[model samples]
Target: MVQAALQYERQRRGLGGVFLDEIARIERHVSDAPGLYQLVEAPIRRATLRRFPFGLFYLEELDRIVVLACLDLRRDPQMIGVTVARR
Candidate 1:
């Protein structure tokens, strides 16, 4: 099992609070069902919540999962990467 960590700035965004809630939900799911998460590439992977327009991006490390950012589908994913790196 992999431990999970959320970036600080990403936690602050809240994105009207829904983002944080969704992230927590994802973390719980990941904790219970790590195998269900799909790889997007090195340093990044995504998991979607049913009926939500958002996706969670995370880094799968050997000991833990680093949640880089939670993104709304309408936003630019590239920019989100830059933001996560900056944080």
Candidate 2:
């Protein structure tokens, strides 16, 4: 996510901040309603960012949610599956 922010910053002056803000907004939604998202894998759920091509992968647990990854949507599905699996 930091890398993506840095890349966005390179593209424009405050674009990185905008990207981070979007991430925060999406995170808040996930925190407020973890079960609102679809289950991509067996257990892992994905919350996609509104303005960016990134998806936040998390596991909804009994007491809390566990964020596994914030990955670029452009990445290969197989690689994403592997990375999420490892986490």
Report the number of the highest-lDDT candidate. 2
The TM-score values for the models, in the order shown, are: 0.57, 0.96
Report the Cα RMSD per candidate: 7.6, 0.7
Q: Give a tens-digit lDDT track for model 2, residues 10-75.
A: 999999999999989988999999999989987899999988999999999898889999999899
TM-score of predicted structure 1: 0.57
Lowest summed lDDT window (length 10), candidate 2: 35-44
Question: Which whole-number lDDT from 0 to 100 does residue 24 have in model 1?
Answer: 75
Q: Which ranges of candidate 1 are over 4 A from the true structure?
A: 1-21, 77-87
Q: Counting only residues 3 or more apart in sequence or on different chains, how many pairs clash (N, Cα, C under 3 Å) in candidate 2? A: 0
Off by over 4 Å in 2: none
